[model samples]
Target: MTLMHKILGTAAAFALSAGAALSEPAMIYDLGGKFDKSFNEAAFAGAEKWKAETGETYREIELQSEAQREQALRRFAEAGLNPIVMAGFAFGSILEEVAADYPDTKFAIIDMVVDAPNVRSIVFSEHEGSYLAGMMAAMASKTGTVGFIGGMDIPLIRKFACGYVQGVKAANPDATVIQNMTGTTPTAWNDPVKGGELTRAQISQGADVIYAAAGGTGVGVLQTAADEGILSIGVDSNQNYMHPGQVLTSMVKRVDVAVYDAFMSGADLETGIFTLGLAQDGVGYAVDDNNAALVNDDMIAAVEDAKAKIISGEIVVHDYMTDNTCPVK
Candidate 1:
């Protein structure tokens, strides 16, 4: 074998490897979207992990308008990418139509379910995780009242509120839950100004501790908590860093882990609605480098006890439409 022939073969192999890596699909992030450091960041972490370990390339389309949702998904499909990942509950219906049309391509959506042979729906037992957060807030609250703020009026967001209400009540039956929505539209998650306003309103209503599940809007809630000198709970991702010292603890939803796992296991994007909750490290409390000092050992121990009880089947968190037969409106 001549030296020239050996070099040519090596170059060809390298090109083929590069081509394969570039063929992977992209991800579409919902509005109030990427770098939220709460929700979208979790999905972004998954894409990053894919790039680092699997050598796959993924792009993200930040949704600004409703039309962007359809356009972004279609653009990725037309570009010949496979398994486009979509984040957020807002894309539920969009995933249904796109996945059906692009039978050759695969689609993965988080937080909602759509039935398509080519799609995988990744959901979370958010209620279960929120329930745990509720317990933490109740135990940690000095004011005996905590507030719940949701990003939207959708049933999905309600799940978070319901779990929180139950968890707090279980911990301190006298605990009052003041719930508010950022908005009724998809823009609800993105409006931090409104989120803060609502947070302030809840504070006025006697809520000493507030939990913001309103995506980017939650940032406002965190800011309010910090500015007002009160306690706040974060949602979707570890938000303890949002306000550093003021954020009591975050309801850690392992969205990053979910995104990474899906990327690693591609063939089964269909027939899978991977729900991450307390048991799978999919959701829990966040306390490491950021706000560990803010939470006492007893709080951690109690949360751990609740976790074990949950895992051991002693506690079953309620889904508003399901287990919560007589849900409080």
Candidate 2:
């Protein structure tokens, strides 16, 4: 059976009985919950896929507060959950603390690097995918301007914004790309109202197409963009179906694959730093029936050419994390 827990308080603990068998895997979602329709949801999809294919169940927890990070990890480890996977980079420090205590238990963390011997760090080339989304935005814009809204003002989110600016300039050097961040705290991931406000603000600045790299907040960005009769880009998942043709495309990140691979490996999962990028099929843009009408042949051919060049090392999408600087604007 699948064990699901909603941890609302830091004092709350996983209800596993003492000395429970060390068999099933466990997942710990970030503060945005499992159904945020973005990053966490992607991870949930992977876990569900594993359950459907193997007829096996895993344990999971949707954390409700930042204080629950270490608590959830420690409790799950104590319960003998092997190959525990966490869905955010916020777990890096806490995982560092907990992984050493349970050297026998394997752990996997997405979006952050925790150099524990028993931990697997899964990171994505978000900049590369964002570049494609930006290119599409620039190509589709009617006002010669685009926008980007990110969730936390961290290096990771800036990575998305930086690549987007570069792609916009690459497509139209004269194009204007406006950028904003939801906030500096984790709450930035869930505030949709602020996201909508940012969308309108960008639209006022002549941004006819906006790309949202926020988590749940991106939902507001997409909704507001559609309500205002403009195009929006999604992140971390294929969100095209959310608004049909109104959504230009989504920068699809394979968070599901990372979770599925970890769950499939069970206790024997490999532990190392894994970076998924355009070449590894780790990140790319989504094209489906929902938004097929918006993408033209020219756009597809240009994006495909850029993708090939990136994989072949001819086009280097600058990683913002490398130096916290974007060569473009």
Candidate 3:
């Protein structure tokens, strides 16, 4: 659905009168569009699921430009929307600013932390999941070399790459992990052309398995991997269906569940940092029928073993944001 434009004082009355009976959740989708088929799509899936189960409709806006971030948040907040949901970390500063002006409104933001009392920040153990994807990529690689394509050169995406490299090393210490970022700006998230070029470059370096944590850009990475007949891994959502046999597996992060839960919580939605990890079943590797043939029983067993260790604290996946360095990479 189209988003309402941000305007000052127009929604002030609506905000004052907001309550349980008038509560209506609103969502602000991040750039790259909601159908990026990766991160934003996962959040959409969760929002859709909530609507189907509860028969309640919510307002939403898809961001088309960088300026729209704050505009969407303010527009929804001023309109008396009870719980405003934002899809990405880019909204952190904006959400923090808007939330204070509307203290009665509850806001839920995924992938970022907002210190406002009314905001619920949800983050996932993407590194843990990416590590598993790394292990699978390494094991599935015939060339003993794998690659990683990131959407943007941000600390968050680096966290994905570092964990993947760690996983690759754990499985095959001799394996080489090549890495590249689509771009240094937000445009990187949706640049399929750049994604394809990066994939080809990695392949030229002997990388047979590539993991794409590049949002919409990953579509290009996956398509190229399939065209070149190389194994590839997907991120954020279960993308095995995209390439079927050619896709080794997808590092599934449950953005859908986070969104679904927030919407379901309604007016009383809890506000704070909510972290989803392997232990909480918030992040994992996809192993459905789509890629069942590509992942054998041994691979499944090995990954599961590692998963258990990670959850039990026996294995700690280093977070790249922790120190801005990847030991394995």
Full-model lDDT for every candidate: 0.79, 0.90, 0.89
Off by over 4 Å in 1: 1-22, 54-56, 266-271, 321-329
Error of 1 at 20 (Å): 9.3
Q: Estimate each model's TM-score.
A: 0.84, 0.91, 0.92
Q: Model 2 clash tally?
A: 0
Q: C-alpha displacement of 247 in model 2, angstroms?
A: 0.8
Give the Cα-based TM-score of candidate 1 against the true structure. 0.84
Query: Is 2 or 3 the stronger prediction by lDDT?
Result: 2
Task: For residue 157, give model 3's deviation from the true position in Å.
Answer: 1.0
Candidate 3 lDDT by residue in tens digits, 89-124: 989887777889989889999998888888899999
Please give, for residues 1-329, the per-residue lDDT of candidate 2 as tens digits.
Answer: 12333222211322343233336789999887898888999999999999999998788999988899999999888766778999998899989989999997899999999998999999999999988888888899889999999998988889999999999998988999998999988889999999999999999999999999999999999999999999999999888999998999999999999999999998888999999999999999999999999999999999999999989999999999998899998
Q: Tell me the lDDT of model 3 at 279.
A: 93
Give the count of colliding residue pairs in each prediction. Answer: 0, 0, 0
Q: Give the worst 10-residue stretch by lDDT in candidate 3.
A: 1-10
Point to the candidate with the largest lDDT.
Answer: 2
All candidates: CA RMSD (Å): 5.7, 4.7, 3.2
**Between 1 and 3, whose lDDT is larger?**
3
Name model 3 segments beyond 4 Å from true: 1-19
